[model samples]
Target: METCSLPRRKLAAPLLALLTTLSLPTPASSAEIHSYTLPQQAYSGSRERHYKVYVPSAMTTPAPMVMALHGCKQTNDDVLNDWGMKAAADRYGFILVAPFITSYDGLRNENCWGFWFEQHIHQGAGEVEDLHQIAQQVDAAYSIDPNRRFITGLSSGGAMSMAAAVAHNDYWAAAAPASGLPYSEDSSSVSLSGQCPGSATFHAVSQVVSDLTGEVDNGYPIPLLLLQNKNDCTVLQTAANNMRDAHLQVFGSGDFKTAATTKASDTSCSPYNQNNYSCHRIAYTQDGTTATRSLVETIFYDGPLTTPNAQDTDHGHYWVGGAEGNNGKWALQIGPSYPDIIWDFFSRHSRNGSQPQGHPVIVLQGDNPLTAELNSAFSDPGATANDLEDGSLNVSADCSAVNTQAAGSYSCLYSATDSDNNSTTATRVVNVVDSNSPVASCQKISASPYAHIGAGRAYVGGVSSLRAYANGDNVDIGGSFDTWSSVALYEGETGKWYSQLPAACSGTGGGFVCQNWNTTNLNHVTAGRAYYGYYTVGGNQYLGSLPGVNSWVKETASGYFQAGQCSN
Candidate 1:
């Protein structure tokens, strides 16, 4: 237990008198508080401790037990009276056990439980062993349920309670550590020296718990409920976040999902981060094959300190109820009732958990491919679905968005539903692209009978010329080939064209052919400047170029001028 050491100040006379009047006990309540002394051999050395149990007079059947621990410099009587545990027990029909820590003059400066010490906290020895024995003793004396045992504490007691729950997890079903630090190897040192950040301390605590409890594929072995104050300066909010993260890491291995989130009403509490005093309520469930249950829950409250010093500043160290000191300045003003929330959560869970319903699984076929050619057909590959409880599910697909006639990417969804109404879905992508190329041919014509004319032929200007034709299987002959075909003569070595047909060729019977040569400005043939004829249609859909043919040379043949003279 750590105490906030602040300068003492004198209180006003009237307020001091009022606090004195409130400190006195009223009449005896319906619940009877019983005191019990532990066996001398139960604890180590002469430093012995006692425990108090709260049992309602109306108790007839076996009831659940909650082991509550107090902070440093606090007694079991203070915890019972100030925290209203007796009243809670009467209302909730449960038993309450509060233990008092004996002061050690030289060993400890404060009357705090030795929760930080290694020997006192571990299994089979120290405080944990003593607490276990006391539980057994209480069970024998009163009707107690073994599966419904729980533990909680504040400050150092809260820290110790966490350690006890971990060491004796087999006995305790759940634990709630409110405004408390985690039990770590460095805890004893930190408590004796000073305090560290909550996250740094809890990281070490997580490692220690992992070492003690062998790592399992499933989530945390025991359910946990964490409570913290947003404005707490002593314990700090980081500690609660770290503790929550640690428990989630231990228990959130499989398909763990957040089930619900509840925000407190603004009228009941102040807003922190736009959330009310009972800031937020988050619940998580781990749906494992063997055991499915709600594993963890957390509540963050926005309020003044549980105990405020003389300066009206809150240290936020105590449990939900205000303690004996500070004149009720640290009492909760707005938020959900703490005792009611705690009992509701605890009562709903037990040691034997329930099985969870599994979700459906959907498997989709690989990506589909299609061509963009006109009138191309498309067929879906389909999908598959399965479930653990619901056998093979009927999978339905929707490919209405797919248009095979257009050239673009498209998507469709495959979905399935189980008997339990659990649904699963998958997406398939359809890629459509153009896969057709245009077919074309060119022929050279010679005016001179001496020139050889064929597909690969060339003749001098004014003596012969060339013509080309093209057609596309997937393209509109009149709109594409007829409107975009052309022919040109270019330098074979340089690839620089000398001239091109001004406009597209006209449409013939089944294809498109180049226009009349006389209607175009064809470059004059020149000697020693090698050139070739080229035909292009539909933006490179089809292209024709000269194939290793030499330009014709001027010559005289049969007493007539000829342009078909070749060296070979």
Candidate 2:
């Protein structure tokens, strides 16, 4: 953690009041600001350190201490500007501390947290000792609650926080790491010592996590609140998943399977089920972008830190230190609402091998994308399956509120779990599209397989084809037939009704046999009725008409013509 303390530059009365109101509360009404000097030892020599502290005014007795660690290439003052842990301490009424790392080049200017474990803390013994000394000094100076001490950080600071949990587990009640992972690094020039809080050392948090579940090899699972972003380009989301899985592999005893899932564009989470500890992973995926935020909440079945379930702060830098978030830096900060959620989780948990309260758990969608409806169940011991496996839990969710946009009734059926060790057995279904009437086209047709036919003449009957093509729509052929009554016949040469046709030409010139003199009607004749009526099938049309007579003959005034005919 970086340590330079930011001065209390007074603000406008109104603005100061507003900021003060925004602070999380303590029993006291005001928070005090103070600074301390710490001594540290380096591979080459020794040095002194500095850090800032904020004490809630309402706390008469020892109040909880929360240490905030800064990220890499950042200073304590820089973190203060980016991460607003001080404001959170004032509002929440908890003691806040920010420690600084020292440089070994005798400059004391290139500040950095010394190695987390004694292995490195020894090389720079003064720096680690300075941190411990400051804590002791504060313990003596005020009502500092030793049992309720907590540590949290981001990036490199986050890794250091893990080290702190391993190296100083007795000093902190819980640990929260944002966008960070366990150390697997070897010694390097930049980092003089092997990782701090190495696997060889297991503190209270890790020991309790291991003891409850039964894993001994991995770094102990401290009472932890893990947050990561699925879409984070810098830190891979897989690391967070691995951490959650390790917990379940050691503790879970029932039938639940872990699942990878997302709800919107901003985040995502992995699945884990074990006795006492239930994995709550959140992923935000909006549009095509992956959500860069993840939250890991752990609870003890028994002990002073037992809670039904833990709530976590958002992980996206966009929402960090905003009115509703925790962790991260950039344009958007964690919100004011974040502190409460963090405290709620921490207050209910400890790495003491205690049984979780087994509180009835409910899952609800937050403002983020990876959300499911509230599910009620008892977190039981052992491995537990998804809620869908039991056919009792409803993981249907509405994703319309994501990205602060008004989405139209979109929902999803997802997998989930409860405390009872049961699994989801059925699929949940939801509808998101509209059910309004379809759009209209320029034309319409009969139900199915329908066609128009030509009215039969007095001596002939035939079928007429009607084919209409409409834009943006299709016509149905309902296998039914109707007749067209608009056909009229007239003599092409005489200007009169010429109801006759030319007979076979084998005889004198061309024997006339009631020739079809209606030029207009004859000109309109073509091919089959279904087609455009242009081609002739062997010099004749397939009009359902009587045979044995001159083909193209107009019907008499009685409305009958002579042509080929078929079955009724």
Q: Identify the leading candidate in terms of lDDT.
A: 1
10 residues in a row with least lDDT, candidate 1:
519-528
Cα lDDT over the full model 1: 0.50
Q: How much does candidate 1 score in TM-score?
A: 0.48
TM-score of each: 0.48, 0.40
* Per-residue accuracy of model 1 over 1-568 as CA lDDT, tens digit each: 1111111124444222212111212113355776665544433532455778777655534677888888776778767765656656765567888887754323553666676576776766677767776676666555677777888877677777777877787788788877666555344332232322222233564574464455222233677777777766666666666555566556555434223221112122211111135456555556522222356666777654422212223355456642111122233313334454465456656565421234455544332332234447777766666554565679989988888778788888888898899787767677776655321222112222122111222222231323221111111111111223333221111111122211221122222222221111012111111121222112221112322223232221111112333222
RMSD each, Å: 28.9, 25.2
Q: Write the per-residue lDDT of candidate 2 for residues 1-568, one digit (tens) a residue.
A: 2223222225444223212112222223555566665434333334565667777654435466777766655556545554556665654456777776644342211343443333433212344344554555555445666666677776556656655554555555677766554432211212222332112221233433443233123343345566654433333344455544443333333332132332222222211111112213332221212422222352111101111111211122221343322222331231222344455445444344232312122222222222222221211111112221132244433323322122133333334445564323222222222223221111111221222222112122224434321111222222224233222222212211212221211232222223233222213232121111222222233433211112343332122233332211
Cand. 2 TM to true fold: 0.40
Worst 10 residues of 2 by lDDT: 300-309
Compared with the true structure, all predictions reach lDDT values of 0.50, 0.38
Q: Which stretches of candidate 1 lie over 4 Å from their true place?
A: 1-29, 42-47, 104-109, 188-209, 212-220, 255-278, 288-293, 306-313, 322-336, 353-568
Quickly count the clashes in candidate 2.
Answer: 124
